[model samples]
Target: MTKLTCFKAYDIRGRLGDELNADIVYRIGRAFGQFLKPTTIVVGGDVRLTSKELKSAVTNGLLDSGVNVIDLGEVGTEEIYFATSFLKADGGIEVTASHNPMDYNGLKLVREGSRPISADTGLADIQRLAEENNFPAVTQRGVYKQQSVLGEYVEHLLSYINLDNLKPMKLVINSGNGAAGHVIDAIEAQFKARRVPVEFIKVHNNPDGTFPHGIPNPLLHENRQDTIDAVLANKADMGIAFDGDFDRCFLFDETAQFIEGYYIVGLLGQAFLQKHKGAKIIYDPRLIWNTIKLVEENGGEAVMSKSGHSFIKEKMRAIDAIYGGEMSAHHYFRDFNYCDSGMIPWLLVMELVCTTGKTLGQLVNDSIDTYPSPGEINSKLADAKTAIARVRAAYEKDAVSVDETDGISIEYPTWRFNLRSSNTEPVVRLNLETRGDKKLMTEKTEEILALLRQ
Candidate 1:
């Protein structure tokens, strides 16, 4: 069997040409078809230059396996999820590297109802089958057709907000030259068609696979300044930026201060609680106090799940949670088939701003003040486990509580931190949060880092 290194804990991603080319992707498509034996599958890709050809190759493989394919041309990852469930397709695949460098490309797969196909959930089986590169001959080939889901997708997104109350607001939207621009354009047109007031100041709005600005990853501190600068220059009510595939979005307040994803989790949770007071809200275990406090304060239940889309989505479905959020900026909605959408979050926040007459800053300022966090910090070491063990041992004595759902989370009376090892690298991630004390948060962050480094 030919060894393949592209498969990760969650999805398939690797450098282009060398690790993931048309031939390899074709085999993956065949393997996926063979493994699931689905009658119909949905396929889509991001704005990467190679995505089109790769998607075509994969679609051909699916067709060769006698599996019907619905091609959603050049879309965000969430679109595949939306189309899969919305079309009632048996399976789906998205050809996207999502914020990786230009030289990389990969896939994200989901089974029926858009349930994630992670390493534990049939991805490994598909990987092994692809590595074997063996397939049985089929007498007939499946059919293929190109379908546009943008109109329906826009209507679904609009369903999340009250059209009447979405007051005319000036907003700066930066697409980072990724696949998000098309959807934004569609939504803007929908707003205009409905006569709902919304003014969009678009930046890098074109879908450029070359990523003229940079890869659309606002998670990196360096890539955020452009969006922040645009928001301030335009004097917009708020700014939203999305990753290459647009499944994850980062927000900035009217003042152009980049809001942490941890706080956004709380903000969005509160927004949902307004309509469904007793609903359940799932959050990652990395940074919990803010989300937990907000959900509880609003007469909702807060449940903590391990970080990662598969786990978050699974927990959300299990508990019938209305929403799930990760501090890394992935927001999942039950209404969206338990899939995360970059579009839904900003719209909800916009509605909140219009209805409450509050700036984005005002909405999340209290959460930021109440739970100050030294956003996720990382350290590369020869032995990540040893580093995590060191931190756990050091804090085990003083911690009032410890949870190991995803990583080692140690809680104190007024402060807490979660030290987790990366799934893809030999590095440890540290996130520290304190109850209304920036000084203590800073001190604990450094103190924990010192121990992690030791």
Candidate 2:
């Protein structure tokens, strides 16, 4: 049995040989199966080279435990979540590192109805089982079967948007050689058949394990320029870029200006509320989103949640929220089992534009002005806890309210800040926002960073 130190607070992730390999992944599968005692398990993988081998090991282990495996080969992480809930499977796992470098790989697991399994839930149990290296052996092994859910997935996505009477627009898409290319292709084909006048500009649209361009994470300002450039160079209506497994997507307007995810959250909330009046929308507290205000004004309820996919999904399920979003570009939908999807957000936004007779930029420009935020700045610190304490100490004297749900959050009258330590990295992420005061936002950000650096 491996030590399995790679089992993180959220998922199992590690460098290829140093921490994870087929053997370790096989044991994880056995442990997961034994722990859940799942009747049927759904499995999928991204475009990484190591993913298929990991999937094979996992499936073999599951089969050995008398657990049937439904293989949805070469799909995105959200697809696994969707399939797990849609098919009412006992559990699901997706082999993906999700925007990590090529040498790293991991697995995202969930139980029935696409509920997340985090450290507090069942991850520790699985880790303990893996460490024990003992699994129940079944006399009769279960069977493995291959299935193609991509077409149905695409169709279901289209159902969320109205493609009927859409205007002709050029859309730029950079897949970054990840798992999103084929899904985009499938969706584009459907749009074509329905006579939706859309032209797709595809870049790096093939799945390449080496990630010749780089990791596909669009959160980095450096990684987003290509998509922005493509939008401008082609005079496209808009551009969208996807991360490694296509679980998160980023957008650029026709003018090549990157649209902040906060504004997108507001746009989506309004959209969802238009259909389902008074429905609840969930948002992370990192960015003091005016989106929440917008939701409330639009007669919808907005609830603050801790940052992270697992927490957001759990909160969404608990509240029966229709939609939820994080500033990191993760968007979740109740229809999609509250799982984050890189594919759904853009489609819905596009549909919003087509239905409203407005351009994407025009739709979100107002919200950007209302809620100016210091887009998540990360500072590497020697001690994250100390840095957080320093910031908290500075603000606690006159703070309106302070909460430590995920980290240190101090609320003032006009501005607020959340300094959160990352789960996987040695850095404190700072998100500051003000009630339309850009200068105060800048000053507070510098003040907090200076305190941390001190």
Candidate 3:
């Protein structure tokens, strides 16, 4: 039996040659088919150089396993989530690395209804089956067919906002040479047809497996300059940049200031609450006060879940949350089967900006001012657990309240912070915020970092 290092806690991801290849991917597909016993499944890939080949391998394995395959060629991860529920497929897998390095590739899986299939939800079984490489003979081979879900997917995205209310706005969309270009083009065509006065200034909008611009991850400060520069040069109303698979999107204001994902989460929650009063909004535990305050002020309930895609989606499903968001820029909508979409967020925000007569900066200024946070900061340590414990011990005693919802969220009267180890690395992530005092927030953030480092 061969142990697969590619199988991760959340999904499958690995370096190109040694960890993941066609053979391993094929076994994974067969194992998934066997585990789920699905009659049909949807499969797609990102713009990575190896994604197409790997996607084919997985699709072939599914077919050989007597599971019909619906191939949606070259799509963002959210599209797979959308298609799985949209087409009523039994399951879906997207071949993507999703902000990983050039040599790494991975898979994102979802069961029926586009619900996540992570470690707790049968991924372990699939991994075991793949490792064993033992399978019963197939009585019948499943059929394979290629189709385009772009039109329907585009229409579904349009459903998230009012077309008529989208006023004249100049926008900078940086696809980072990934899979987002096609969808943006499709949406642009729609805008043209509807006579919507939205103009797009495309930057690295073409899909290039080479990733000449960078890895398409907006989280990295160095990777964001092109988008920011484009927005400024074009004087666009807003700027949007997507990750490799486009699952998460980062935003920029008209003034070319990058908006933190934390504020985006709060803004999105407030928008959803405005639309459906008393709606439930799910947020991650890393940062909460801003989102919670917004939710309360808008006649909504805010719920906190562990900080991850699977956890957020699971909690959203459990509580029937109208919308959910993570400070990492992943936005979820109930209308989209509780799946996160990078595309949907920007559109909704655009509508919110135009209709509310506010600039992109204005929409988030108050939230940032009210509950100021420096966003998530990471500190690599020799012992991440010890570092986390040290920070908790230093503050928990004086904390007015402490909640270990995700890691350890400690709150005082005027300030709060969450310190936890990374899911995949030996690093402690610290998120600190203050009550309208950037100085105090900065002070506490530095204080926590010092403790974590010590």
Q: Candidate 1: where are CA atoms >4 Å away?
A: none
> What TM-score would candidate 1 get against the native?
0.98
Which residue pairs come into collision in candidate 1? none
- lDDT of each structure? 0.92, 0.88, 0.91
Candidate 1 local Cα displacement, residue 271, angstroms: 0.8
> How would you order the candidates by TM-score, starting with the best?
1, 3, 2
- C-alpha displacement of 157 in model 1, angstroms? 0.7
Report lDDT (Cα) of residue 45, candidate 1.
Answer: 94
Task: Summing lDDT over every window of 10 consecutive residues in candidate 2, give the lowest-scoring window.
Answer: 365-374
What are the models' TM-scores? 0.98, 0.97, 0.98
The lDDT of model 2 is 0.88
lDDT of 1 at 218: 94
